[model samples]
Target: MPPIVLTIPEAVTASKMSRTAIYNALKDGTLCARKSGRRTLIPTGELQRYIDALPPYTGKV
Candidate 1:
């Protein structure tokens, strides 16, 4: 199967998080992305793992 990779915009949308947030996550070791020429791509598998590791959502007042 083709490796599932997402561009910055696509990843931002997928994660519902800002590009800066994504970059910060990468810098802090919470996220990992690959740099190809002028583009940064995030592997879908890694993205999924990150999501799965997130704390559960809690509705709050």
Candidate 2:
């Protein structure tokens, strides 16, 4: 089973997004995360939910 949460760097890799983009999403309330001491973790389920909520994509041009 996948871990319940992912570190920022791990989330970036898993989401295929830049660190800035992740931070922007977090700041804008588009994504959710939890602070564990000094580390911020994004829940795997939240990540999946975010992806699931995105509009359907067309094929690459």
Candidate 3:
């Protein structure tokens, strides 16, 4: 079958998050993910949603 999902690495690249950051986001419930067997798969739609909804980043508070 064709590829219908984006993997963790792809999601990280798209999300511009590091591995630890992604895991942290997942833990914090800010980012969403799924497990397929032994691999983590992130839905492109949801990734986009998160990206679009992310708050603007500044140098500091």
Q: For each candidate, what is the lDDT? A: 0.87, 0.91, 0.78
Error of 3 at 39 (Å): 0.7
Could you estimate the TM-score for every candidate? 0.78, 0.84, 0.71
Off by over 4 Å in 2: 59-61
Clashing pairs in 3: none
**Which scores better on TM-score, 2 or 3?**
2
Task: Quote the RMSD, in angstroms, for model 2.
Answer: 1.9
Tell me which residue pairs clash in candidate 1: none
| Candidate 2, 1-61: lDDT as tens digits | 7799999999999989899988998999989999999999999999889878877888877
TM-score of 3: 0.71
Best by lDDT: 2
Better of 2 and 3 by lDDT: 2
